[model samples]
Target: MIAKGTPFVASYSGGKDSTLALWRAVRAGGKPLALLTMLDETGGRSRSHGILPAVLDAQAAALGLPRISGQASWGDYERVFVEQLGRARAMGAVAAVFGDIDLAAHRQWEEQVCAQASLAPVLPLWGEDRLALVREFVDAGFAARIVVIRRDLMADDYLGRVLDHALIERMLADGIDPCGEAGEFHTLVTGGPLFAKPLALADGDVRADGDYLSLDFGLAASI
Candidate 1:
């Protein structure tokens, strides 16, 4: 049986890592109380990859999770992010889950924030083998698509492609991190083992802005 009253918040980015992390948390007998995402108010983008907020909401709904989001400018990231987390804490969340792998600076920042909020930081995929983890995500029935690609490291052709074993193999063969930890690519989870339903998105044009190539998906009719 899962632990009762152990409210936990999953830091969701609509990415494979966050999807896998939340799945692991659920499997570990923790109650997922909420999902948290940071929205960029200035550019109407997700902080990490510039995905549309509407798409993120659709993904959250598919996961059957309530989301608590905050909009902030680039300069206000740390403050607004922490404030949103504190709100989650006030709602009785005891811990926060992250899907980070082998990023010391990220881990340190997460620890600091959790400490401030008095919430335990859980890194479910930390220090795991990147290639193995990618394989696991695909094999475990998660449906992820490359929504953003860094132009210098990866071509724009990868945008909007499903992240499967074939994609993982190709990435590995190219000496790129299978998980795209080095900003080679970013993904959005449309369907996954943890989702109660699949997100319905209308395909939009891919736009290139400076160093990033982003695929836009707008909300169609919800399924």
Candidate 2:
């Protein structure tokens, strides 16, 4: 149970896949101890989807968990991530959870890193149907919005669009992976069963990030 990892620290990306993975892990008796994210060397944005630190903080607050993060360049992403895993392990995490569905390379890398940190690797969504995984997240009451898209693989118009049934179906019809596992798109989860409350997000301008286009967002003004 729990893929042999309890009291795990989820490798969170502030995205739906990771959120769903965390949910399923808890359902399977995993003890979620903390969230871990990798930030760019600049220390301003998350490397996975360009998510801001504030967004991640809001997510952690909503989930009632602490976060462990490290800033690193692509050249040292693995080292930094391993160090972060070490930090989580030192905090009593026996394993690290991931959201990889069907990507062999991704899983391999995750496993390697967990091994380096002496932590078990948990993959709750591993081998699940891609389309069904997306549906599961939506049907389970989780809400997310597209926050980044690869310019070569997807249209920029998808930025800021919520991951609803319609959008998923359209992506499938267009030959895009609904799960976006191959990096076609990335999302920021706003609300879900795992959260104490939904996050309020205010849209901002889209900025180009090399081969990807990222949308900026912030916590909405509290009324």
Candidate 3:
């Protein structure tokens, strides 16, 4: 468990795993100082999920946390992330929390970067059973929707669908990972126990990038 009452920076991706990690951290009495996100080179969308800045802001607002985002290309991602972590450290953050479940290389990088920034690395979901983790998130009342999927692995119809038992069963029947850990899919969480209110989203255009088909999502003006 994280040291209670200690301020920590969350490696937020606006996805189910990160959301669950944040939720767990809060429940364990960790104080979230900021939500750190990596943006594309233009700083318009997230690096992995393609969520807009406004959309991420809404998510941060819902969770009542500050959003700290940085823009960088693939070549400079590590440097940019470490720079942000340094800023967070200066802001009194002693640890960095991540949502990675079982990626050894990813965890190593997270630890290395945190060490460089003078912060300890914390991974709440490390080594947990993937399928059980999905059930835990859903049962804990966290709501999320699919936002991207591998075109070769799933149909476009899978996009924008809620992550729930039915979807889990379907994915299982289709022989796909429930958590989509193998790059099978990605999701955007809209509501959950950690949120003060739900985010309003609208479906935008669908575009194909590499092996993935992404469903662009826009935030509603009400936010």
Candidate 4:
């Protein structure tokens, strides 16, 4: 773990969870030097949440911090991610923060990657009640939109919808994880307490790839 007040890097996906984790970390007095995003092989979108680089750049700008990214396909994902952490280490990050909650495998992988990069793995939401965490996010008034959904797991109509308490309750009633931790869906945070200014995004095309449906979110997101 990082010493109190020391700077660290966050494994940011530009999603609700990651954004919340970083915000909480800052609130606890930790200094953040940068946000590290792993990008797909094309270097266009984030690997985890499929957020465009331009939008994430806007997020970084809003937070007034630098954004660092590593690009790779599945074959080289680990190597590239470790390299990004290496950069984080060089930037004086003693620990790396992630947003995972209650997923053992995800924690394990995070630990392994942090180990390889000589940094500690920190999960602020680890082992917390999932529903309570979702409530916390909603109460915080952070606005996020469901950008990608696994059509087999959830209805395609859920795409591009704003995430809120009512929708989360519906998800729970449908036996879906409120946080969509099981690959059911993913989101992009548009505005939050941590943002100096809200992202001005336009909804874009809705496209299907395999069993997944994604919204480009009006492709030209900027500050």
Local distance difference test values of all predictions, in order: 0.85, 0.91, 0.92, 0.88
What lDDT tens digits, residue by residue, belong to model 4 across residues 122-200?
A: 8888888888988898899799999999999998888998999999988988888879889899999888888898888
Better of 1 and 4 by TM-score: 4
lDDT of 2 by residue, 1-223 (tens): 3843479999999999899989999998889999999999998999979988998999999999999999999999999999999999999999899999888999999999999999999898999898898999999999999999999998878889999999998898888998997889999999989899999999987899688898998888722
lDDT of 4 at 19: 86
Give the Å error, residue 131, model 1. 0.6
Give the clash total for candidate 3. Answer: 0
Per-residue lDDT of model 3, residues 1-223, tens digit only: 5889989999999999999998888899999999999999999899989888888999999999999988999999999999999989988999999999999999999999998999999999999999999999999998899999998999778999999999999999999999999999999999989799988898888988888898888876633
Tens digits of per-residue lDDT, candidate 1, 1-223, equal: 2254467898888899988988888887888888999988764778887788778878878788888888988788878888888988988898999999899999999999889888899998999899888899999999888888888898667789999988877877777787888888889888979778877787787788888988888877631
Candidate ordering by TM-score (highest first): 3, 2, 4, 1
Q: Tell me which residue pairs clash in candidate 2.
A: none
Model 4 residue 217 distance off true place after TM-score fit, in angstroms: 2.0
What stretches of model 3 exceed 4 Å from their correct place?
A: none
TM-scores, all candidates, are: 0.94, 0.95, 0.97, 0.95
Query: How does model 2 score by TM-score?
Result: 0.95
Q: Which candidate ranks first by lDDT, i.e. highest?
A: 3
After aligning candidate 4 to the native by TM-score, how far in Å is the CA of 98 from where it should be? 0.6
After superposition, which runs of candidate 1 have C-alpha atoms over 4 Å from their true positions?
1-5
